[model samples]
Target: MPYSRLKNLWGGTKSLGKLKVIILSHSQQLVEVDELSEACGLEKIDLQGCSSLKSIPHTDQLKNLQLLNLSGCTRIKRTEVEKKIKGLDQEGGLKETKSESMMFSTLAVKLEPGDNTETY
Candidate 1:
C-alpha cells in the first residue's frame, strides 16, 4: 500500500506493518505518518517531492531505520534536515547502506511549486 495514503485507510486510524522502505513523492503534508515510525518500526523512507513536508517526524522509535532521502522537500529547512540526519546517524543501531553516506543524502535536483525534486 502507498504509505502516503495509509491514513485514508479505515478513516485515518490503522496501524501499519514494519515497512522497510516508504516513498512519498509529490505528496501533501506528510504529518499523517508521524505515528508510523513508532507503530511500524519504519526504516528507509524517501520524501522526494513532498514540498509540504516541512518537518521531520520524531524517529527515536525507528531504531533500525537506516536510509532517508529528502531531496526536494523545499519547505524543509536545510539546517533542520541536517540535524535530523545527524541524530539518526548517531543512533548507531542499524546497518546502513553503502550508497547512503551517514543517514541521509540529498541529491541535487530542482523543486517544483508543490512537488519536490527527483532522487534515487
Candidate 2:
C-alpha cells in the first residue's frame, strides 16, 4: 500500500483482522502508529526509513509480533525504543529469542549519528 503520504495510522486501520505484516517503509511523512497495537496478530512491522516517525504503539498487547524494523527512523530515540521493547520482553509480549534480541540491538546501533543517511 502507498503510505508515503500517511501521517499516522489511526481511525479505521485498527479494525483490520488477521493482519500479519505491515511494511510502511520510507513513509517519510508518517509520524505515528498509535493504533497498531490493536493488530494483535501482527508478526512483522517494517517502518524502515520512516524518517519522520516519532513513536509506535506499545507492544505489550502484540504478543505475536516477531520483527519490528525501525531502521533509519532518525526522529525516534534509540533509548526510548529499547526501553519500550525491554518492558515488552519483561511482560512476555514478544517471543524471546537470541536472533530477535540481536535484531533490535543492531537496529539501535544503526540509529547512531551519521548512520541515518542510507536511502531506501
Q: Which candidate leads the pack in TM-score?
A: 2
Strongest candidate by lDDT: 2
Clashes of each: 1, 0
lDDT by residue for model 2 (1-120), tens? 435788977666447558889989889999898788788777778887777887876666676676677766666654456655522221212222433321232233222222223221
Q: Where is model 2 more than 4 Å wrong at Cα?
A: 87-120
Judge candidate 1 against the unseen true structure and give its global Cα lDDT, from 0 to 1. Answer: 0.48
* Model 2, CA-based lDDT: 0.61
Tell me each candidate's TM-score.
0.53, 0.66
Query: Alpha carbon lDDT of residue 104, candidate 1?
Result: 26
